[model samples]
Target chain A: MTQGRMGASGAPVVSFENVRKVYGHVKAVDGLTMDLRPGETVAFLGPNGAGKSTSLDMLLDLRKPTSGTIRMFGSDPYHAIKAGRVGAMLQSGGLMPEVTVRELVALVTGFHPRPLPVEQTLKRAGIASFAGQRVDKLSGGQTQRVRFALAIVGECDLIVLDEPTAAMDVETRQAFWVNMKAEVAEGRTLLFATHYLEEADQAADRIIVINKGRLLADGTPSQIKARAGAKRISFRLDRIDEPFLLGLPALVNVEIRHDLVQIQSTDSDRTLYALLDAGYRPREIEVSGVGLEQAFIAITAEDDRDGNGTTPGRSDSAGVASYAQH
Target chain B: MNSTLALARAEVRRLGRNKRYSFFSVGLPVVLYLVIAPSARHYHVYGVAYPAYYMIAMASIGAFSGALTGNAQRISQERKDGWIRQLRLTALPANAYVIAKIIASMVITVPSTVLVLLLGRFYGGVHLELWKWFAIGGTIWIGALAFTALAVAIGYRFMPDTVQPIAMFVYFVMSILGGLWFALSGFLAKIGDVLPTYQVTRIGTDLISNQSVPATAYITILAWFAGFVVLAVIAVRATAETV
Candidate 1:
């Protein structure tokens, strides 16, 4: 929220200053303070019901915060929407299922005073050939892409996507990131909500993870993972040696009954060197670094009541409420 | 006015996309006037006015289509699509939306009125009187405004998907069983006298068959339209929910 002049009115592309969205007795988002600059892509990583969409919705002004303030493009998102500056591909996407893709894009663009030409929009959405096809006839992944096209057609400054590629596959998802990188290169800001760690690792300049409705980690993709960092160091011995590795410095506190070692040390480099020096030139060695997915799991799992992905709903409410107190 | 016209054009296009209401807006009144109004003197006690009847029927199509098709459904659709939320945040002002809706109804109503006249001239053996033309056209337009308001007001309460079937049923049931379909007379006839279609229809019959429309009937139809207008204005404000 610390401001400059990206917006027409001198606001950041998006700023959430202690924003809290309360629904009845529950706080969907609590004290979420985030900022996005123009042309930056930030991925919101969280498990289901972790308030990722709720935060996105509030920023999009589809849902209003019960308290605090969110400024998109230096004004309220609702204001930005009217100004035709805030663009979104909501979780619902709001596609008229009966209309052809061309018509859907045309109708949405019609709301803007100076939308991109229909042909260009169709091509950008990657559905130029499917423009005449009915939306109901398209696959879910294809429909998701159409939503993406519509959001960008206004040539808006900020784009908010809530689970944009939820229905996409491995190949399509890879291709989508390529297409998205190209789109982002055109200087549009993106606040993407995604569950895929690899997607975040590949597509995001920065990553923010939310657990129990509060910001658990926020930094560059590599930084956040490094902060919650652990590594899986595995080697295939001639057989299993449990006590031998446990007694060594690199493999200290090793659960080495099997041919596996999980080092919780901050320095994987030092540990791996120790392993090699201890006459442990193994047949095979695998040292996998900490990843965003594991970091999310580790953070949420710390507060988890059960092993399930479900965070005690009340805990998020309490956690978010606690945010306001601070 | 240009803004209103722009919105109106879009609404008209959107309304035409619905098959059920496309018939109500563009097809039903023309088909019925063509097939039925020629021999209205047969069912009625003589001295019937064909053009007045056709005009009332035409005007009511504007009223019906305005309430049931675009205005009513648009309210729900906007709310569901977050269009209302979007507009409220804009400088467009919610009143502009209401004005646009009423104006759009006129866009459809005016054409439907012309089509009805053409159908009456070709198939019903009807002719419009100079004075009767202004009287019936004015009455029909007033009726459309009222119905359009009520339709939008009610339409705002439901989602678009659920609105169509219920609205279509109301229009069809009223048109047929409420005596707009036939000239049934009695207690039901008394109730029909108050219905916009019934009163507008009877007023049109008087204007065409006898070269005179009842002043009382015109006032009653206009009053009903006024009530709808008031409700519509209220509905727009309530749903606007602006601070």
Candidate 2:
């Protein structure tokens, strides 16, 4: 009823349908299809040259996709942007170096039809103290904060940031998330692109992973790990028979080096109980959720095998589970 | 409309703060005018006194160079720094952006024109009726529009590192060919007659001396203006499409 395809509450805030951007013979973004609902925080997670930036560029109308369409709030990207409904923080663009931070923010705020107060925006971005300083004089983290202030001053409903925290140090990155939490609390829709798995895991409600211009996985952080069946359980054992370990319930893969045995499983508790009931004394057992980094590697590796059928190591059941999770 | 005005004002403020821009575009012209105009004060060429002839010529050089080089350098730098990309993302229309840049370039041309004219009157001992002074100044300013378009085209076409040198070289070549420094004759005169700078300076000199400028000069200048404007549009469109 609400235009194209509607999500849970209503029409999706953003949608891409079979979008393909080809530069020469190389496809920068190939057959991308996704939807982002309003009031949700989503992260596009990809490694370098994985088409994340190209997708963001198309969404912002800065670059036209070679084929297919993209819609923002049920409208074309250009119209949505022109209506001042979308704001963005680009990854590595220069600000006017000569202007003070306050003046630069004020200039950008003036472009929006409904801008927030300059002082309030500055304070919220945690750059109030440096407002009078010229932009060229700021440290890398402070400059990133200023760029953040520029993004939020427009009173936009949807904020898109392409690698917003790439320039920040660890402490600055932490503080940035704190400020971002406050902004997202207003029920605003947020989409960010990042290669940092941890940032995506901690900050995003949903993660959409892409590799080689294709969508590899799409789900909540926990759901992605769960779907990949990549929970890791490691322990030290004096001796363990490899064949017996492979037969453990819910164990997808096993790696044993020296006295350490690491098991990847769908259900770590079941595998641990299996080890105990089997009379294997595994000491110093550590059960940790497979970090998104590992899951990403697994997903991409599976994708590579599926594409070429040359490299073969993953079991059929493990590969089927990953496919079925999508 | 408000957005355009704000952008133009910001550009003007930026130019005001840039000491290098002021020196190269405004200060250097005045110094050149003062140093050169006085030496030729007592001379006459083609029935026009030297002071009046050199005054209008030098003012033309200053105004044309200031508007063209100032706008071109800023555009190339902004393109290099990614400010142009930032602006493209905003709701501000492309035409508005172009207009704001032109307005800013015009604003920069004022001081250089005024300073050169003042030096002509005080230092070179050139005397003209009040209306003629206004007329000559107005002609020089209007003629700068052609160069403004050229600036935009050059800015969008070239990289920041090479833009300044290119702009300087073009200005120098055009100025010499246009006879701003001295009178041209024979083959040189024929080339000078066809150039836009030559026509622009003629418009200014003709106004100050109360001589009617041939209609062809006006037509030629307008034709060059149209051509440069078309080039600027093409350059900007090509940049937008490719990037």
> Which number leads on TM-score?
2
Full-model lDDT, candidate 2: 0.81
In CAPRI terms, model 1 is classed as: acceptable
iRMS (Å) per candidate = 4.4, 1.4
Clash pairs for candidate 2: none
Candidate 1 residue-wise lDDT, B60-95, digit = tens: 664566556556776677667654543343334336
Query: Once superposed on the true structure, which residue ranges of model 1 sit more than 4 Å away at CA?
Result: A1-11, A96-100, A103-107, A134-137, A235-260, A270-285, A305-326, B1-7, B14-19, B45-55, B58-103, B176-178, B209-243
* A239-296 per-residue lDDT for model 1 (tens digits): 5556655555433235454655555444567777766787777756777876778766
Off by over 4 Å in 2: A1-7, A237-240, A274-279, A309-326, B241-243
Specify the CAPRI tier of model 2. Answer: medium
Could you tell me the TM-score of candidate 2? 0.92
- DockQ of prediction 2: 0.62
The TM-scores of chain A alone, one per candidate, are 0.81, 0.89
What is the C-alpha RMSD, rounded to one decimal, of candidate 1? 5.7
lDDT agreement of model 1 with the native: 0.66
